[model samples]
Target: MQWVSLGDTGSSCPAARSTVAAFRSWADSYLTQPSDELGRDGPVCPYVQPSIRRSLLWLAQVPAADPRPMWVRAIVRDALEIYPELPTRNGSSTSVLRALITVFPNLKDHTLIDEIHAEFKTKFVERGSMLGQFYPGCDQPGLWNKDFRPLDAPLPMLVVRGMMTTDFPFLLDKPEWADAYVRKFAPTLPAHVRSVMVGRLTSRPALVPAYEVRPDDESCSTSS
Candidate 1:
């Protein structure tokens, strides 16, 4: 995990400084609101306000890491055009997140990067009795099926971190996403982890075909 300086707001325009304040405000109280729509309760979110406030700037201005151990290493960006003028979405909430990957696709522990973006998207679109307000472009139903998700978020933001081996089960239902998962993670996974993924993937006919594994193929070998 990277060291995170919680209360530091390096240099910023007056406007950006204020935006950070607004974000922190939301993170403190608004995020804690009990939303039957979000399945969120009054308990403060574990992500914490300071982390969200400084993360956008941190991407550009991350100083050398401190020599001490840290609790969490994460990246965040505001897509609302509200603060720090980070990045405005052309409609898709995920545009900023995907753009980040396009710019720096390879990072240490690629798992964290994939995990955060993928989970956020999934959580936003999820529609049960629990979550319904996560939709992004409310006026534009063309962006997503209205029957399922209207796609709206109170604050447009994306948090990113490495993907974890435990998250493979969630990706198995999405073919393109699953293939990307295999490409990014299969190369670095522990031998045991790889073997488990191969076993699980072979039974998931809906998603396994994209990896194109065969009994004789070396590319998908668990030993590799």
Candidate 2:
């Protein structure tokens, strides 16, 4: 919904700008739909579809050094909100996550997705009867074990990038540059949360040698 001027149009072609405008229009139309009517509508709701489109557009617009904007969170939340059946949205979450990764590949780490999954579990799953709201035909534990599990690895990096970009500024002195740094890393962190990513990336412990194995190493074998 936020509109910023495309400064320095010299480098961009007219066709490209037109395409961008078209995409934005499409997204705007999608987000404006009524939530109550989304279910009776079908697989592709006008509201939800535009959010997905907007997500992709925003991701393309992001600079390599800058973290994604806070607006992106709302965009994603809106996308998820349109569907009545949790299963449909939950399943689409995977696609959404994948789209994010395609934009920011560094977010391939499972740790980030795990955090999002945990939040979903705490927010929705803990409420017992909320199960039907997410998935129509499936049970809670089954959905958790199946769809949600596989989704963790491939979730979109852009979503994590947006989270970090939006939150990191309040936590640091050089908020602007720090946001850029966080985006570059595609870290799954809030603005104020200190990330272990740098430490993990830089620090390596000396590897100890494995115990020498003898040719007839009976100790190594387990007795049947």
Candidate 3:
């Protein structure tokens, strides 16, 4: 498989060799331990701030799509982006998500994108919140938590990929989002799939029913 060096910026998936090794090392170290700061039991990047910094830098140029699809593969690749230069006060997880959503159109797959986003939110945000709290009583994430530090990783990052069919539930809830979703996914749907979606969207009754029925007048039928 052809690979590009980090920052080389040619085609895609261009992670440098050293950067990959370094990321492996950092991931092994940080991911191996539980993060006490956030009162969580998972790898916390901030615990090894510098290591995460270097990894994020490498991720900036590495392509998010896996070669299997681009070329055959088992693991799905997800894109990672960082906004390090933003002003301290201006940086937030919301900002990262906005940036990610803005770029979603260009990517090839979005299922992984949603998965990655949810992963971070669950691991970092929901782990110790009312969703995860106990004994003291169920409280909202912000108050009553020890530090309220889910999105506060060592770096601000967003994972993104092409959108997927499962996204319809989220998109179809709103008229505007549904409209946009139709425009985006319709062109790619099979004729039958498109017909089914259009049928549902337009609130048209299905043409076929489960059981056979007499044509208009059952009395007209003659018994053999």
Candidate 4:
């Protein structure tokens, strides 16, 4: 029999070409498989799992001296896309704020910080309102008696006595409701100073009107 090298015969040698063709056919058959047969537990495909941490770290490490890079914002938005659940956590947004503050000290300026704080407060108020919609307990009226009067006393004593007379009964009857009220109320504050003032007012024993207890209402009066 005459021998023909597979390379020299090029496309014309059936025998030599058949063997090469057969090998390729077999290799391709062995490599290709039904998608269902592939194990799901194997490492996630690279195209599916982007390196979120590395990108975030790189953004964090950017030189503070340079003006805030446009890429950092893009990376942040990308990271949020990769992990959409991040904003749901209470501290997660605050952590991002702290990171930005570190990277851009200009964020600490009173005007800028106040603006950001106001924006966050607005978001929190909106969230609280949404929560109130789902949980109507957030909007319920005071269960205590309005006519009940605390004894006349000094300023602090009068306040305490008044709360005991009006707000304490309901708060005591429903401590969980009191707590929910506090949480729903606190987020409406636009500034730390306003928050402090609101906290002082809410902490006193005073009956907040049902209408005034809406998620966004920060002004609660001592009287019903």
**Candidate number of the best lDDT:** 1
The residue-level lDDT of candidate 3 at 215 comes to 60
What's the CA RMSD of model 1 in angstroms?
15.3
lDDT per residue for candidate 4 within 1-224, as digits (tens), equals: 12222223354335334433432342234323222323333321121112222222111222233334354344333433333232322444322211111122222222332233323322322222110010111222322323322211111000000011112233322334444445644555356635544454455534433313345454555665
C-alpha lDDT of residue 19 in model 3:
39
Candidate 1 local distance difference test against the native = 0.37
Task: Give the Cα error of residue 176 in candidate 2, in Å.
Answer: 40
The candidate that achieves the highest TM-score relative to the unseen native structure: 1
Looking at candidate 4, the ten consecutive residues that score lowest on lDDT are 153-162
Write the residue-wise lDDT of candidate 2 on 4-117 in tens digits: 222323444454454344434533453334333233433322323544534322223321333343443343343234222222234353222112211222333334333443
lDDT of candidate 3 over 1-224, digit per residue (tens): 33222233343343344434444464466444655554545545332343333222223322444322331111112222122222223344222211111111123443443444444433222111101111112222321245554432222224222234434544433344455556655677667756655555555223323223446665556864
From the highest lDDT down, the ranking of the candidates is 1, 3, 2, 4
- List ranges where model 4 is wrong by over 4 Å: 1-84, 87-103, 106-108, 128-208, 211-224
Worst-scoring 10-residue span by lDDT in model 1:
126-135
The C-alpha TM-scores of every prediction are 0.36, 0.21, 0.25, 0.21
Please give the TM-score that candidate 4 achieves against the real structure: 0.21
Model 1 / residue 112 / CA error / Å? 24
The TM-score between candidate 2 and the true structure equals 0.21
